[model samples]
Target: MADTPNGATPQQPAQVKMQVLAQYIRDLSFENIVAQKGTGGDVKPDVQVQVGLDAKKRTAENQYEVLSKYNITSKNKETGDVLFAMEVEYGGVFLIEGVPEQQLHPFLMIECPRMLFPFVRRIVSDMTRDGGFPALNLDTVDFMTIYRNEIERRQRESSAAQPTNA
Candidate 1:
């Protein structure tokens, strides 16, 4: 390796280009078959939601797969009946390269997710409210925490299954 004037290897600048080639809700489902009977005359409704994030390598060089999925179930507690069930999957392909290893996780978790979230959020809110129920608003997620937890979980599982000698 060539050394700089200071006798240390020169660090390469990161080359990162983040662009949203396309943004849309990939899949959406809303089930309100029982809304009429459950709400007991179009009463107020409550919704509970869960969100998850996942990433994978795409076929193209330096391309990535990022997905944000939400599962929401709305109910009328007083009647102990279901109001609506919705599931949505939002995903995008990101092109990135030359980014430092330390910054890669943040780029995917924070920056990429931020780009895709608004579209997803709108779908959830619009669909629920339009379906004759209160809007379903989701809280923002901390992608870094989710990414780190996933890594740690995988490591723990692998370590547990491996032989001690190996």
Candidate 2:
């Protein structure tokens, strides 16, 4: 393993340190259909949003790529019609080094997502509020729980699909 520029030896054996290299809004799209209609002068708008997260290794190097995607929809309550739809994908490059093999999964699935989520949340909030809607601040996500659930689900599916040698 290469020594960190600080020259301090890793405290743990092959310790992994995740460094945020760069964070940016990769893509954003918003559409306001109701605003174009020029109607519903008194009706309040209802908004719903969904978010997703994904991570990938950039290369054999210590770099990682994290993606946070959001889908938001706004509707005019009175008309029961779509008002606006927005989608945004925020991404960042992270440097993970000296990580032990056993700890790599947790480091990538939990810690990395935790580190990247705040930036993604801010973008969604800002975009919604600035786009003439209320701020859509998201609640904290339990990535560990999500990861475990995903693993369990996959395992169950795989086991169910396999044939037992009777």
Winning candidate number (lDDT): 2
- Candidate 1: list runs displaced more than 4 Å: 1-12, 41-46, 78-80, 101-106, 163-166
Estimate the Cα RMSD of every predicted model relative to the unseen true structure: 4.0, 6.4
TM-score for each predicted model, relative to the true structure: 0.76, 0.74
For model 2, residues 73-134, the per-residue Cα lDDT tens digits are: 87777877887788988787889889876877767777877887887778778877787777
lDDT of 1 at 135: 74
lDDT of 1 by residue, 77-152 (tens): 6765777889999998888787777887668766788788877888888998898766777787776677778889
The superposed Cα distance between candidate 2 and the true structure at residue 24, in angstroms, equals 2.1
Reference-based lDDT, residue 53, model 1 = 78
| Candidate 1 global CA lDDT score | 0.78
Runs of candidate 2 with Cα error greater than 4 angstroms are 1-12, 37-47, 75-80, 164-166
